[model samples]
Target: MGGMARYDALLVVSFGGPEKPEDVMPFLENVVRGRGVPRERLLEVEAHYQGVGGVSPINQQCRDLITALRPEVDLPIYWGNRNWHPFLADTLQKMAADGVTRAAAFITAAYSSYSSCRQYLDDIAQARAKVPGAPEIVRLRHYFDHPGFIAAMIDHTREALDRLPEEDRDHARLVFTAHSIPVSMAASSGPSGGAYEAQLRAAASLVAGDRPWDLVWQSRSGPPQVPWLEPDVCDHLATLHAAGTEAVVLVPIGFVSDHMEVVYDLDTEAAGVARDLGMRLTRAATAGTHPRFVSMVRELLEEPEPLPCAATCCPAPRPRGAS
Candidate 1:
C-alpha cells in the first residue's frame, strides 16, 4: 500500500437513520442522548420519523456512495452510523478484528460545528479506549472549500433552479439550509469561530454568486425556553409572501444526501408551508453520489498523509459519550 497506505482502510461515517418503525424513538433518543430533550420532544421528533415509515434514506445513499467510490481507492471502505447499526464503536472493533492497523475516517458532515465536526473526532477517541492497537485515525481535512465539491453543488443548484416555473425562476429566493442545533452548541462551533455559517456561505456562493439569494436558517429546534436561529423557514416564507415574493428555490447545501432532514423537513414540512402561502418553491438536489463528490472523498482518502492539524483544527468541544 503505497499512496494507499494513508490508512489500511477508509471509513465513511454519517448520522444513522432508523430503517424501521419501531427503531424511530430509540434511534432519535440516541441522537439526543446528552441533550436531555424530554420524552415529549423525543416523541415529537419520532412522529416525523414515523411519518416516513421510519426508514432513513442515508443508508441507501451510503450504499450507493460506497459502490461508486470503490474504484477510486484500493482499500476496503467501511460504512458506520453515528447513532445506529454497524455503529462507530462496532465498526472500529470490526476493523481491528480484520487486522486494520491504521485507518482514515471522513464523517459525512462537512462542517466545523461541535456535533457536526469535532464529535466525530471524539467518537474515534472514545471508541479507541476499549480496543487494543486500534488503527491510527486520520480524520480527513474539511473540504468545504474544495473545488470539485463547489463545482458539483454549482451544477446541481443550476439544475434545480431550472425545474421551477419560468416566471418564478428569476424571482425565486434562494434558500440554503443545514441541520439546526442549540445556540449553546453553536457558541463554540469553530476552531476559530462561525465556520459553520462561513462554510455554508462559501458553498452557497459558489453556486449562487450574483444570483440573488438570502441566507436564512431552517429546522431550528430547542426546549422551547432556549433560543435557536430565528425567522425559521415557516416565518421566512410568510414574510416573503407578505413582501410579494412569489417563488423560491431551496438549496440544501448543508447536506450531502436526501436524509430525513430533506425528506421530512423540506418535502413534508417546508414544502407544505410554501404550498399554503401560494408561493412556488423548488429544492436543489442533494449531492448523493455525484461524480465530483465521490471523487473528492476518494482524493481525501488517497492523500499521501494527513495534514497536520493546528491546536484548534476541529478539536472536540464536549467529551464524546459524555452524556
Candidate 2:
C-alpha cells in the first residue's frame, strides 16, 4: 500500500518571472519551454519588463507573503517559482531535506483552469521525482468565491473608486481585467464548463452590484487567425472614452499576486490605452499580503479541501493525434 502523510508544511506556488532584464526571454522560454514560441514574441514579453525598470513585481510579492506567513503556522512555508529562482525542484529538495512530513499548496491563481491549476500539479509531481522523500502533496482548492478574498477585492475596488475626483466617481465604469486566453480554449476550458469566467464575473458582481462594470481580456498571444476574448482592454477603453466615459477603475481578479500582468498590462499597456483615449484610469491593487488572504491560507491549512473536479473540468478537447 502507498504511504499517507498529514498536511504540515505549506507551499505557496506561483508563476515566477525574471528579476532582471537579462533573464526575461529565458524566463519566457521556460514558460513555454516545450511549445515553440518564436524568439521575437518572447522579446515582446520582455519589453513589458523594460517598461517597469526591468523588474517583475512577483519576487517582491513572494517575499511579502513569506514574511506574513512565518508566524502563524507551525510547519515551515516555502515558495517555489514555476519558471524562475527558488525554482520548484530546489525548493522541494530543501523541503524534503528539512524533514517536511506533508504539505498543502496554495497556487497564486484563484481559478481552476488547466494552466492555472492542473499544470501546477504537474510541476509539483515533476519536482518531486527529482527531490527524493517528497511527502504526500495536496493542493488547496481555488478560492475565487472565498468570502474574505471576495471581500478584499470589494474593498480594494471601492477604494480605487474613492480615488477618482468625487464628481467623476459615479461616472467611472468599473472594469474587471484578467489575463487573456485563446477563444478556442474558452469554449470549453475551466473547472466545470465555463466556470472560470463565471467565477470571475461572480466575484466582480460582488464588487460592483448596481454599478457599471465590464470584464475584458488582456495579454493575448497567438496567430492572427486565432480569436481571443474581446473586447481587449485597449478596445474597451477606447469605446468607453468615445462614449464620453471619463474615469475607470480596473480590478484584476484573476491574479492573486501583483505580477507582470497587473504591472505591464494594466499599469503600462492598459494605462497607455486609456490615456490615448482621454479616459482617466486607476487600478485596484492585487490582493498581495492582505490580512484576509493570509487568513484564507490559514483556514485552508487548518482544514483542507481538494480542488474541485467535475465531468466538465478541463473541457478542452483532447488534442488531435493523441490515442
Candidate 3:
C-alpha cells in the first residue's frame, strides 16, 4: 500500500556526536562497539573528542538542518542518530507514540560505503526491531551528484578559494576528502563493488570543473595492517607542497557537516601540516543548512519515491576475525 503518498513523516538520520564533556567515552564506545579497533586507537579518538571539550558539532548541525526544513516541508520532522544521543531507537519510539506510520529517511552521508550507507540501513533495521509499531522507513536516494548539493559545494569551494591570496587562488588545487573505509569494504561497497570510491570521484570531478584536483581519504580508524583508501588527505597535502604547489582548497564532498572529522582532522591536523609547509590551505564548508541543500531535501521528497537498495547492495564488511 506504500507508495509516494504513503509517507507520513520525514526523518533526518545522522551520525550523532556527543554534545557535552561527559559523553566522550560512551559515544566513542557506541561508534566502535565491534570491528575490533584497538584500545590505544580508541583512546586516541577519545582524545580528539576530549580536545574539543567533548562536544561534537554534528548533533547541533543536524538540529539546525531540521529547523531549517521545518518550514519547507509539511511532514513532521524526526531526527535520529547512529552513534550518540537521540539514538535511532529512541527516535522511532517517539515516532510510534506520535502515531506516525511511515517516514522518509534522509541520511547525512551522501556517498556510498559500508559505514555511510549499509551501516545506517542496519541501524534503521535494528531500531525498528526494537520499537514496536515502528514506521516503515524509506531512505532517500544518494544525492552525491544532485545539482543542489553540487551547487552548495561549488559555492563553498569558491568561498574557500577566495580566502587564499589572489595570486594563488586561481591555481589552488582542489583536494577533496572523504572517510576512509577498509580496503575490503571499499572494494565491496556497492552491488558490484567500488561504488564508494566511484561516487566520490564523480562528486569531486563535478566540484573541480576545470581546476586540477585529487580525491583523498581521512579519519581512517582500522588497524594499521588493514589497508584502507590510499593517499590520505594530509599526506596528499604534503605531496602537493613538495611538488612546489603554492596553495590548496580542501573540499569535504563526502560529509554534509563540519563534524569532528572535518573540524579536528582537516582544520586542526591537516591545517597544521599546511601551516608548517607554508602552503596556503583553506577548507570548504559542508552543505549544512545551505539554502540549496535544504531545498534539495524538499525536492527529494517531491520526486518519485526512491526504490530501496538491493539486499546485496553495500554489504557489511568482513568481520575482523573472519579468514
Candidate 4:
C-alpha cells in the first residue's frame, strides 16, 4: 500500500494518435513500421482520421485521463505515447531531468497480447535505453477483470441499453468487442499462449454477468490473406440480424477510451452496418475518466509490485513475409 515509497511518479503510457490531417499518415506509418502493412492500407486508415477532422480522440483522451487521475494520485503523473508527439523517449527524458528515479506505469491498454501488453513494455525499454538516467518504469498489473473496470463497463452497458427503445431494451443482445490481431499473435500471446483471448473472454463474461452475450473482434488491419480474429463486429452484426436479433448493445471491452477505433470503427462503420440491416444498435462507452476507473489507478499503484512478463511472453510477431 506504500505506493509513494516504491515509486516517485506515475507514468501514463498510451497508444498515441495524430492531432491534425498532416500528422495522420506519419502517425499511421509509425504504427505499422517494420510490420509489412501495405501503403494502401495505411492510406485507407488515414482517411478514417481525416473523416473526423484528422484528429484522433486518443491523445485528448489521454490528456483527460491524466487530468482525472491527478486528484486521486498523490505522485506527479507524466504521460507518453508510442507513436506521436509527447513520444515515450521524450517523456522519459523529462522524467530523468525532473529527478524521478522510479515510476509506476499505467498503460491505457488492459489486456495481454503482443501489441497490448508486451509491445508497450518493449516501447518503454526502448525509450529508456535512449534516455540517460531514465527512471525505472514498472507497469501496473492487467485490470481486465478488476472490479472497478467491470463496474464501470456494466454501468455504461446499462446506460447504452436504456438508450434503446423500451420495447427493444429487454431483448437487446450484448455484444462485447475488442481490437483484432493476427491469429498467430493471438495464439502466442502471454506466457503459456492464448492468454490474450482467454483474458478478453474472462473480462467479457464478468461484464456480461447473467446476460446472454457474444464476443467479437473489430479494427482489423493487414493483408486479407493473413488471418485475424473473427467474426468481425460488422459481420457479426449482420449475422445477429439474420437470426432475428433486432437490437444489440456493443461493449468495447477491449479498449480503455473512445479513441478512433471506438468512434470510427464501432460508431461509424459498425453503426452503418446495423443501419443497413435495420437493426437497432447502441455502443457502451469505454472507461474514459469514469470515476471508478480513475480510482483504479491508485489501487493498482498501492498493490504490491507485479512480476514482469517473461521474455518469451507475448513475443513480437515476425514481420510479414519474414521466413
Best by lDDT: 4
Model 2 misplacement above 4 A: 1-5, 307-312, 315-323
Query: Which of candidates 1 and 4 reaches a greater lDDT?
Result: 4
| Error at 83, model 4, angstroms | 0.5
TM-scores of all candidate predictions against the true structure: 0.92, 0.91, 0.97, 0.98
- Least accurate stretch of 10 residues (summed lDDT) in model 3? 1-10
Model 2 Cα shift for residue 296 (angstroms): 1.2
RMSD of each: 2.8, 3.1, 1.4, 1.0
**Model 4 poorest 10 in a row by lDDT:** 1-10
Candidate 3 whole-model C-alpha lDDT, 0 to 1:
0.91
- Model 2 misses residue 35 by how many Å? 3.6
Clashes of each: 0, 0, 0, 0
Alpha-carbon shift of residue 306 in model 1 (angstroms): 4.0
Q: In model 2, which range of ten residues has the least summed lDDT?
A: 1-10
Pairs in clash, predicted candidate 2: none
Show the colliding residue pairs in model 4.
none
lDDT of 4 at 112: 89
After superposition, candidate 1 runs with Cα above 4 Å error: 1-3, 308-323
Higher TM-score: candidate 3 or 4?
4
